[model samples]
Target chain A: MKEAAGRRRQSAAASPCAACKLLRRRCVQGCVFAPHFPAEEPRKFACVHKVFGASNVSKLLQEMAEQHRGDAVRSLVFEADARVRDPVYGCVALISSLHRQIQSLQAQLALSQAHILHLRMRRTAAAHLASGDHITSASASSLSLEVDQTARFY
Target chain B: MKEAAGRRRQSAAASPCAACKLLRRRCVQGCVFAPHFPAEEPRKFACVHKVFGASNVSKLLQEMAEQHRGDAVRSLVFEADARVRDPVYGCVALISSLHRQIQSLQAQLALSQAHILHLRMRRTAAAHLASGDHITSASASSLSLEVDQTARFY
Candidate 1:
């Protein structure tokens, strides 16, 4: 027990990487996650581990090539952050909320466009009536008025 | 070989639930998914299975309460539809697109409100300048003009 305690103290003195330290695991030499996830930002790994279990993350990192691991880690971190913030839906909620907003905005855009078109048509008709011009042969003044009104956006 | 063929025919005659059929598994007695997903709507299960794999969905269904299962299935279908439409981001893309739209709409709303406020303030300042009226002693007629302009919203 005394010898084991002494070895543990020595290992502690060496200072494990942030992930292993937070996870309370021994950071062995050639730890795959250490280089990408440093000791300073334990929260990054904490959120990732919380959402996608540490083992799964380990498996994913192990499966990917060295060149791709960095990007994979970044994507995982972003998704994990979204997941942690909204537990039930995680990133999905963000996506759904955004979808709803798009629907509403699209509706609003349609309405605004329709209103603009209606206003333009009404102005054209009124110009024709005021000038007493026929349907096919609208006066140049009425045409110019139509252009001016349509061009005047708000 | 004849006996195996007979057994396969027997199983096929039973007609598995949509979920089981899509997954190419036998729909045994008391399948949790059977009641919610009938055999007729194979496409429903196909989309759901395509977006969220069978095992994860099964696990999720198993974890939820019996009462909540129906609604959960419905939401899953909606999300799966969105996912299938946008494979790369799945539902996340819909959310992101909506979020971007919401941001833009919110910005537009703010601008419109600001413009209305600025217009009101200018009108008020002009009225004050024209009539030499004190801030608190403004007439009801001036306020009525503000209301009329705002009410003229198309």
Candidate 2:
């Protein structure tokens, strides 16, 4: 136990976390930022520190539980990066853009469905005429509604 | 100018911002939390403070531009609320859920288009047969490929 603790302390003294390195501070053992912001990924901490100050992030991490801090830090880094890129909208802009795509796709799907129904109705009418049976377009349409099964979109 | 400043000072004194109210701290004239976390919406600041800490959030807002601080706070509040609900995933869960919906919708759309093409081909073959034309199903299918235009999914 003493050997492990001494090694951990030596490791902290040798290479600090990105947050501590950039902030020019000592990264002691059990650093809150050490697990999430490794020394190698300096850019992650840089952007996050630029958007939300290093001190603030450190404080926030310290407040969170050890298990939850990693995920919380990830979320903060993502939001901070987005904020740095877009001063106003940030990640909300991506959500809105996706919403627009969904709306456009839904409209297209509805139109395709309507056109498919039209084609089916015309085919049903032609089938009736080809079988030597006389039927109005209205009856053919009813027959289509009765026989056509809803498609399972795979 | 002095009158306006006085009134603004009086306003600040009359109603401290939600963050100040909850933290039991003094809200000064240039309190960064006032505009975003209005008195009526104390819950916004409550969640944000709980997640990100009051001091950290205040410092972050102060660093941001006056015009942008409102949007930034809104984004923070939204993420904070999501984090409170789902401690690990936060708003990222919402983004992932939206992505899944988009993929499912795209699959449904492709299936619908394929079904439409099949229906159009069958109808074309039947039409050829009913018009006193003797053509094999193969030729009728080729005719379908030639005559069937792409449906405008609008």
Candidate 3:
């Protein structure tokens, strides 16, 4: 009895139409057989399987492409790269490189301005010293302390 | 008559009160004179010839300081910076430093992202080559024909 039931299940699973499989639509044949087919049958033969038609494959591919946007973009880039060849690719590459150079230049400018400020501060300190007016006490104290340390070492 | 006229001019400028000079308000007993007094006597005295007071000097200084704002800022920065004495000055300095650091970090991040994208593109290129695809003779011919001299050398 178990052998006969397994044979029935195998026939049902193989019976699903190719159109239903490609469309990713449910197979009524597969669904009808699932209830009567014995558990002893292989899982693939538990019901009739859906077949993928060309149109259904195209639709599924589009949906999958939509889902994996990043991968789709990467593949499209690869395709254009293959088709138009290197002209468009080279232009994109050049633009990106120029953008990097601009960023670097801006960063360098900021760094140079900071250095200029530092130099200005040093000049100010020197001018303050040159003027008869007492330079700020803390700076004077620090200078004196450095001198004392040197004197101790001497 | 010429000596009398010269004497009268000397008496007009030789006055201590700038207000009286400015007002064209002559003092009967004029006292004190600055070296700025005119060597030759003019036929008529005008209110404009009055010696400016400390108040005027202060106002002129204020106006000068306001006008050369950028110069004043540079001088303040380059001069002995008394930051401990001025909290507002310290805040400006600190803000400038932070802004520089932020700009530098932003540049570094952009550089890093560009590098990553480059690596990813290379990897995708390698994968494309590995996957065997049909390259028709027509497409290959076009690519060879369209290939520029720069690309060939590079």
DockQ for every model, please.
0.18, 0.31, 0.01
* RMSD for each of the candidates: 9.6, 7.5, 37.8
lDDT of 2 by residue, B1-154 (tens): 9999999888756798898899888878777787788887889988887766787677777776898887878788887788678765667778778888889889789878877776766666655665778887888577656545433331
lDDT of each: 0.67, 0.76, 0.39
Q: Residue B75 in candidate 1 has what lDDT? A: 66
Per-residue lDDT over A1-154 for candidate 3, one digit per residue giving the tens place of the 0 to 100 score = 9999999987756654443443355657434223322334332221111111133223323444334433322332332232133222212333345557657766555554444444444445555655656777897787566545444422
Winner on TM-score between 1 and 3 is: 1
- Model 2 docking grade: acceptable
What TM-score does each model's chain B reach against the true chain B? Answer: 0.68, 0.72, 0.32
Model 2 lDDT, residue A21, Cα: 90
Spell out the clash pairs found in candidate 2: none
Better candidate by lDDT, 1 or 3: 1
Query: What does the lDDT read for residue B83 in candidate 2?
Result: 68
Q: Could you say which candidate leads in DockQ? A: 2
Summing lDDT over every window of 10 consecutive residues in candidate 3 chain A, give the lowest-scoring window: A44-53
Error of 3 at A117 (Å): 3.7
**B23-116: candidate 3 lDDT, tens digit per residue:** 4545344222122222242211121121112233223234443444333223222211322232223223433455575576666555544444
Candidate 1 off by > 4 Å: A1-14, A65-68, A81-87, A136-154, B1-154
TM-score of each: 0.49, 0.71, 0.19
